[model samples]
Target: MNILAIESSCDDTSASVLSGDRILSNVIASQSVHIKFGGVVPELASRAHQQTISQTVEQALEEAGISLSDLDAVAVTQGPGLMGSLLVGVCFTKGLALANDLPIIGVNHMDAHIYANFIEHQPEFPLISLTVSGGHTQLELVREPFDHEILGKTRDDAAGEAFDKIGKVLGLPYPAGPEIDKLSKQGDPDFHDFPQALLHEGLDFSFSGLKTSVLYYTQDQTNDFLEEHKADICASVSKAISEVLIKKLERAVDQTGVKTVVLSGGVSANSMLRAKTEEMANRKGLNWYAPHISYCTDNAAMIAITAKFMAQRGRYADLEMRPFASV
Candidate 1:
């Protein structure tokens, strides 16, 4: 079966064509307009999708050498993202499904992130997955492809959001997570000792205190000082954030009888986090699953792959399914 997927739940407007387990084509149109704002603006993002969705889907179909008529089904991200952006994709996808006379599947964005591992590796269920994205950070115990028991999640700000907010304080550009992650590699992580958030409650996590700590540390700083110390500060922030994530992931390893751990979501694109996760996973002798940098952010291949599973499970949504901005 050939599946065409759409993912416009955020700043990225993406589409991909998948036939069985192989992807025929994958295309992503990113919004460069958010750079000036230092982050995504929902209305602006939705508008940008409106302008690019058709062209992106067209390019994907062209690259795949297939028309919309060849698609067996249409899949789209349904929730856990910007409402306006999600609505744009959903409405367009619903219309396309109706025009093509194909079954439509609504996918959970977070679930799609985890299933990204399926794009490269086939680590079966009964394992622990740490999903870290711009908007979400959570741990899930997977007993089946569709059955996920959330083990831990951020109580306040998500790891990626924290990265961007801290970047704003340091005068970095918008969408600062990737930038900070890059600079952390060159700078000394131990240059500044940032506080790691320690919340001892079940398996849940919190990053608000750490966010506040970073904010307070810069309260007395001048603009020149911020500019001079930005790189080191970013490195310190990345270190602090990764420490919390690694510690909690380790806890999940000990709590669940599962040895496999999957690192996913947008923040999963970070080099420091990936290195730390890989190191800890190796040290503990656990099987690890993580998506490539391309799959780490919002993309349609993962959405298409996820829809393939949801389709097999008899999980199809009708015209009434609405988007959930938050998971």
Candidate 2:
């Protein structure tokens, strides 16, 4: 089956086309307006999606060498994102489906993240998925397709959100996770021992306390001190986050006795986290699956992949479906 997918759950507006199980094209338009604010502005994000979604969809179809008439279905991200942003994609997708008399599938944004691994790898069932992103962080137990159990989730700020917030404190640019990751490589992680919260707990994750610790640590430091030790600070914070994640993941593995692990979402792009996760998995003799960095972030390819699974199960959404801001 030929399917088209749209993802506008956040600042990026993306479109993808799939012919059966193979992806034909995936095009994304990222919003730069949030850079000045040091975070995503929901109003600006929705407006940008409104302006670019159609063009992005058209480009994706062109790149895929397919026409609208050839599409068998249209899938859209329907929840766990900004409401206005979700509406933009959902409305557009619904309209397209109505006009073409095709079926429409509403996909959960988080499930799409897990399905992203299928783009290049056949992740085994009964696996552990560490889904970390700007808006969410959680560990999921995947028993089968569409059968997921959320073992633990962030109590406050998500990993990617913490990265950006801490980056702002360090006077870095918007979407600071990548910058921090890059600079952390140049400095020592032991420069400062940041706090990692909820360690005694089995699988739950927490980063708010770590963020508060960084805030307090910076309050007594001079500007000169911060500037000189920026790399080390970044390294220290990155290490703290990675350590917490690894500890919890290991706990889940030991408790569940599941050796197959998958990681996805924007923060999964962090080089330090990826390396540490791989190291831990290897040390424990666990099978690990992580997608390419492109697939790690929000993309329509994963949405299409999820929709394909839903379609196979004879599950489809009616036109009355609504988008939600949270799971």
Candidate 3:
């Protein structure tokens, strides 16, 4: 089945066309406006989605060599994202489905990230999944193709949020995770020791304290101090964050005895996360799956294919599903 998907749950305005599990075309229009503010502005994000979603969908359809009428179903992200962003996609998708008389599927933003593993590669059932992104960090045991029992998740700010907060303290650009990942490779990973917040059982993570650690470390420091240790600090902070995650992943694997581990979401693009994950998986004789850097962040292809997965299960949502602004 051909699925038309839209993802505007955050700063990215994206559209994609998928045939079965294969993505025919995916177009993402990221908002540069957020860069000027050092963070995402929800009000502005919804407005941007309204302006760009139409063109993005058109582009995706063009690239896929199909029109809206040719689509079997329309899929849209319904929650766990910016309300303004989510509404733009939901409302637009609902209107399109009504106009074309097509079925609509509501996809969870986080679940779409998990299914990202299915788009590029398929692993055996009962695998451990670690989803790291700007808004979420979770460890789940995906026992079946569509069933996810969340094991551990962030109790406060997510890992990507730490990157942005630290980036602000370090005077880097908005969306700091990628910037930190790119720069950390050039310096020492052990320059400074940052605290790792170990939470209670069930895989709950907390990055709020870590973000505060960076804040306190840079407190009362001159610009020269920051400039001199920029790379090292990036390496240090990246090191601390990655270390905590790998430790948790190792525990998850051991606890579940699942040899297959899949990584998804935005922060999964971190070089340290990738390197450490590979090392950890290899040493344990387990299989690890991570999507390409581009797909690690938000995009519509994941949503489209996830919708296809749901369709096979006879799972579809009506227009009643609502949009949320925050976690």
Model 2 lDDT tens row, 1-327:
999999999999999999998999999999999999888889999999999999999999999999999999999999989999999999999999999999999999999999898998997888999999998999999999999999999989999989999998889999999999999999899999999999888788889999889999999899999999999999999999988888898898998999899998999889999899999999999999888899888899999999999999998998998999987
> In model 3, where do residues sit more than 4 Å from their true spots?
199-202, 325-327
lDDT of each: 0.89, 0.93, 0.89
Model 2 pairs whose backbones collide: none
Query: Candidate order by TM-score, highest to lowest?
Result: 2, 3, 1
Q: Give the residue spans of candidate 1 off by over 4 A.
A: 199-201, 222-225
lDDT of 3 by residue, 1-327 (tens): 999999999999999999866799999999999898999999999899999999999999999998877889999988789887898999999999999999999988888898888888888889998999888888989999778898888889989888999999899999888889888998798898899888334467888998998899888678898899899999999998888888898999988899999999998888889899999999999999988777889999989878988899989988787886554
Give the top-scoring candidate (TM-score).
Answer: 2
Report the lDDT tens digits of candidate 1 across residue range 1-327.
899999998999999998989888889999999999888889999999999999999999999998988998999999888999999999999999888898999999999999988988899678888899888999999898989899888888889888888888766787889889877877778878987766445667777787788899898788788777777788888989988888888898898878898889999989988899989989999988789888989999999999999988889998888999986
Clashing pairs in 1: 38-174
When summed lDDT is taken over every stretch of 10 residues in candidate 3, the lowest stretch is: 198-207
Tell me how far the alpha carbon of residue 142 in candidate 3 is from the true structure, in angstroms, after superposition.
0.7
lDDT of 3 at 219: 89
Residue 187, candidate 3: Cα error in Å is 0.9
